[model samples]
Each structure stands twice: as C-alpha cells, then as structure tokens.
Target: MSSSKKARTHPQYELLYWPGKMPGRGEFIRLVFEAAGVSYRDVSNEEENGMKIILDMISPESTGDSDSNPPVFAPPALRIPGEGKDGKALLIYQTPSILSYLGDRLGLAGEDEAEKAWVLSHALTALDLNNEAHDTHHPIAVAEFYEDQKEESLKKAKNFREVRIPKFLGFFERVLKGNEKQGEGKYLVGSKLSFADTTVWHVLNGLQFAFPKELGSRKKEFPTLFETFYQSVQEQSRLKEYLASDRRFPFSQGIYRYYPELDRQ
Candidate 1:
C-alpha cells in the first residue's frame, strides 16, 4: 500500500466492547459517532481461542506499557489515538464517562451550566435505573441462572415488579413530568439532546421489552417517556439505522433478559 493510504488505515479511535448485545453498553456512544458519519472499530472480539483472550488483553500483564491506564470495567472502553497535554493518549472506559466525554467532543452536551448539570444527572439516573433492572432478574447471583434459582427468582421478581420497576420508571416519569416546572426541557434534562436522552430511550426500550405486562400495560400513563423514545429513534438516523443494522445486535444473556416469570403478575 502507499504511504498516504497507510496513514489513512490507522483508526482515529478504537471502541472496546464485547461485540453484540452483551448489553456491553448502549449503542449511544457508538451511535453518536455513527450518527456523525465517523468511522470506528469495535475491539471487543479478536480472532482467538476464548474469553480468556479478551480478558488477558485487558489484564495488567498483557497490556504491556499501557497497563497503568486500565479502566474500572472492561466493556465499552474507548481509545483516541492521540495523546493530549496530560500524556494520556485518550483511553477511557465506564459507559457514562465515555458518553460524557464524547458528548463534549461532539458538541451534544447541553450548552449551559444548568443544562449540563441536568444532562449529567439525567444520564447517571438512567444508568442507576438500568443496574437496578439487571439486579431484579439476577437478585440471587449473576453466575447462576434464573432457572437455577427459580424459587428465589420468583420472590425477587415479585419485589421488582411490585416495588422496583414501578419505582424507577415512576421516578423517570416524574422527572419528565417535572421538566416544565424545573425548566428542564422536552427531553429528559436540557433544551437539547444529550447522553441522558439516549440512556432514557434505551431504558424505556429495555423495560418495555422486558416487562410487557407491567410497564407495557401502563404506557399511556407516561406520555413524555414514550414521546422521547419515539422521537429519538425517529430522528437519530444513525441510531435508527443501527437498530435496524446487524451492528445494533440482538438482546441476550448480558443485561436485559426477558423473564416471563418475573413480569407475569
């Protein structure tokens, strides 16, 4: 290849995610770039023997010179090729952190102090809700199956549906409803879109898919919640395209799982 082409071949950034919807993270950060028509490579998978390969790459020993900059968790990390003033060559992780960083990069973060705070608050809240959601199904242990702890699952699922799901969704509904009073916006936090909007959209999508009977039956009660989701998918062509694309991936054994026993009141 030519020298010019060789330079072009270098990726500007690398996104590390367990390819496919291990619920590695929402496609939001990835979708942000896609929406902007930028290119990225997902390094969640390698042509190798096992999960060990992926784990080893992130492990302290395998990282070679870069081990000290490792993140708190592996899924959904990003690498920007250039180093800045701090000598940090733009490697970052934690879904929210990455999203927030990208928001600043892409000019999507809300414009004002109040808006910024609201966007961050909204984004973090959505993540909190998502963790609770996963906990509902795996109340016993993540390593064990829902079927393995069917009895404990039943009890936990009962609490989730009766107490938790409604509680979290209800809080979001209140957040949306309070936007006008709080001077937030039509979106979750600011006058413009942010990671918060994306996160909320996914939570609504996951909850709707996960609990059709409980959350699904009561959709009419949360107009703004549905409105944000509806508008987001329709307007964000990249996200809409990703959702329809193979890269968006299918939901499975990672975070959000459909447990009929859990949702079936």
Candidate 2:
C-alpha cells in the first residue's frame, strides 16, 4: 500500500517525544507504526516548534487537555484525533501501554488470548533489558553527566556485558526454541510478527551498537536469537524500508550509547 492509502486508513496518530535524532523510547512506537505500515505524525521530529509542543504537553502546571485525558508525565505520548470523549483527541503516555494499545489495533498483538499474553510478557522483559542498558551509562544518577559517573559506569557496563547480557539473550533464545514449531525462530509468540519481536529486535540492535565487542563475542552462544530472530525482524518488508530510509535514527546519546571504555577490553 502507498502512503496516501495508509494515511486514509489509519487515524492521524501523533507521537510526541523529545525533538532530536535520538531514538529513545519513541523508537519502539515508531517501529510498530513502520512495521504495521501505518501513517503517523512524529510531532517532535516533523512539526515546526515541535519542542515547544512537547514542553507544553508535559509542563508541570498543566492539568489535563480539552480531550478529558489525564496529564502526561513525559514525552512519547500518542494523540489520536477524535478518539477521546465528545470527539476530542485522546492523549496517552508510557511506552509499554502505547505499544499494547497499538498492537491490538494494528493486528500485531497476537492471534489469541494466550499468544497476546505471551507477546506482552516478552515485550515487557525486553523493556527491562532496555532500562538496564540505560542504567549502565548512568549508574550513579540520571541527572549527573556520564563523565562525572564514568567510574561507576565502567563497573556497571562490565557486569552488564558479562552477566545481564547473556541472561537476557539466553532467555530469548529459549523462547524462540520453545516456539520454533510455530514461529520458526522468527516470531516470538505466534506464527506472524508481533510487537514483542520488534521490541526485542530494537533492544538487541541498540546493544550491538552500544557494545559491539561484547555482543559480537557472545553472538555464537545464542544462535537462535542472533542468527535467526535478530536478522529476520529487521528484514520484514515495511521495517526494512523504514530502517533504510531517513526516518530511522541511529543510536547515539539516547538510551543506547557507545563508550569504548565501557565495552569489552
């Protein structure tokens, strides 16, 4: 389907996030829209004065919008026009919540109740890894600069590479192995693609970029996850096109960051 057709079919979904090249948590939402081939407005990236729009939405004094929705705590909020009460736009935040809602709408949740449960379970697990990765760089305090916490970061990153990485990757490899009868090591829950697969793929991609040496050395241990699942998720038609296009941003100072000292020796 073409862009125009997608625009007409799906709601004019607006994604509000920090306006920059960093993927952050917003990238998870972007991956979903891309994989589903849906049209959405990346408010911070595409709109003029997008930064102000985000600030205003998350402002401390703000209570709630005219849409009757609650106040947003942060960015990566989704606004769906006419979805709220009295035909007003609905605003929602939180990455996992947004993914869950969109997953159901985009047919990426799962085929049944059981599969849906597993999809969310696996996605949440992947997000846990994402959070751990962020902490590796900001071990002491999130507000402090990485340079100030370099000593602690080194310790955090070392343990992350040696212990946490293998633990998370091993879990996913087992998931793929258990579902291989249906998923063929490609899908996490059912036969088709789900948000869970996309979620895990992004984390692994970030890890590979953030700690290339650490991941490269361990790839052979998790063949199903690295060799099959990771490669297959990115090659999905719509995701592949989006990744190759300018819409996708490379990891930098966001949740994933490459620090030479923090990686394997």
Candidate 3:
C-alpha cells in the first residue's frame, strides 16, 4: 500500500441567514457552535449568491417541490451535511429548535435528560426576551420601517424599558439566585455551562446594545445574575476568541436596534 494518508472529513454545517451587518437570530446558533469548537460555514453575506440560496430554499417553488422534506418558513436555517433521509443533507430552521439540536449534538444541552429540560426551558424564556426586544422598534409591523411606526414605538419602548425589561431580568435573577442557593453553582442549570447560559448572555448583550442607558442603570439589581453571567461568558477562552474575531458579526439593525428616540431612560 502507498504511504500517503487519507484526509479526515468533518461534517459541514451551513447557516442560511439574511445578508447584512447585523448578527440577528443567527447569533444564538453561532454561539453554540463557537463554544463547542465546531466549525461551520456562515454563508449569509460571506459567500457569493448567499442571499439567493436562502431565497430559493424558502421560496414557494423549492419548498413546494420538496414533498418529502419539510418547508422552511424563514432564514436562519441550518443545513447539515449527509444527515438527512438516504444520506442527504438535513435542513433545520427556527432558532429555538436549531439551538436545541446543536446544543444536544455538541454536549452543551446538559449532563442528563432532566438537566437538558431545564436548559431548554431557560433558553426558550431567553428567546421570549429577544422577541420583545425586537418588537420595541417595530411594535406595529416587522415589514415596516421604524420611522413608519415611530409614534407607536415610543410608547411601546417606554413600557419595555420600564416594565418588561425588569420583569424578565428579575425572573432570571431569581432563577440564578435559586440555583446558587441550592448549590447548583453559578450556571443557569446544574454546575456546568449549558446552552441556556449562552442564550442568556446573548440576550443580555442585545438588551445592553439596544438600551444601554436603561440596562446600565439597573446593573446594580442583577449584579450576580445577568451581569456576572455575561462577564463569565465573555471570559470563555474559545468564545472570547470568536467574539473578537472577524467572523463574529456585531449588533446592528437586526433584532435589537438602537433608535435614539426610543431609547429614552
């Protein structure tokens, strides 16, 4: 036999998302992959015809043509190589489902079934906060521009800043404190870092990016809860490199947009 060695082949993960400078909902999935040290192709704006690929997948033509495959409703979908029926590629969408799938695959879900359930529960709750944060600027309609709903957004944002933010942050704070009281460590679930902690970190980062003044003012209340969690996540070595890398997109017009008029503290 020849002395040459065959190259190892790793599974390819393709992420389909909107082409822009914003991180959007895709950031949640990216965090899991990065923390797990799994390599993935972020094809949103990084590749040629990337947007077209996403458009085609979700379009009526392709979605209707794939009788055996489930239709994807939107972007932020993940395509895994050779994991589908008959050794085809597998496609999964929706942030929560995608994150859960990746979390389980990458061993970030938890150490056991019960712990996984707790992680999923907290992740879904963090998603709720993300949705609410997105709605602050687009209160009336998502398709419409922020200027179109400026009047309504002002009132909605005030309530979000004054009411909803506190409610959700307080809930997380209570959960963290409860976990600590029970000797479950600083993590959201169990004593180890789970996907739930990463989700919470992203949510807190987005909130701070969108409403810096408002969230910063309340830092004293959730010192050990939200603040500490965010700090800890940033300190993760691999995650830190990913965050400082060019591959990590910064928060922009996606999910959490900062409009001066709506960011009243």
Question: Lowest-scoring 10 consecutive residues by lDDT in candidate 2?
Answer: 1-10
Q: What is the TM-score of each candidate against the true structure?
A: 0.81, 0.97, 0.92
List, residue by residue over 1-265, the lDDT tens digit for candidate 2. 2245543777888888999867999999999999999888888788889899999999999999878999999878999998888899989999999999999999999999999999999999999999999999999899889999999999999999999999999999999999999999998897999999999999999999999999999999999999999999999989999999888998889999999999999
Question: Against the true structure, whose lDDT is highest?
Answer: 2
Which scores higher on TM-score, 1 or 3? 3
lDDT, candidate 1, 1-265, per-residue tens: 1112233434466766665435437465666665545566665543344355456546755443353565435656777766533655667778888877877766666787777777888888878878877777777787887777778777877777788776767777787777755433356664555667777777777777777888767777666666654465446766677667666656676677888877866
Q: Rank the candidates by TM-score, best first.
A: 2, 3, 1
Clashing pairs in 2: none
| lDDT score of residue 192 within candidate 2 | 97
In candidate 3, which residue pairs get closer than 3 Å at backbone N, Cα or C atoms, i.e. clash?
none
Candidate 1 residue spans exceeding 4 A from truth: 1-11, 26-28, 45-53, 60-68, 84-88, 180-186
| For model 3, the run of ten residues with the poorest summed lDDT | 1-10
Candidate 1, residue 62: CA error in Å? 6.9
Give the 10-residue window scoring lowest on summed lDDT in candidate 1. 1-10
Ordered by lDDT, highest first, the candidates read: 2, 3, 1
Q: Over all chains combined, what TM-score does candidate 1 have?
A: 0.81
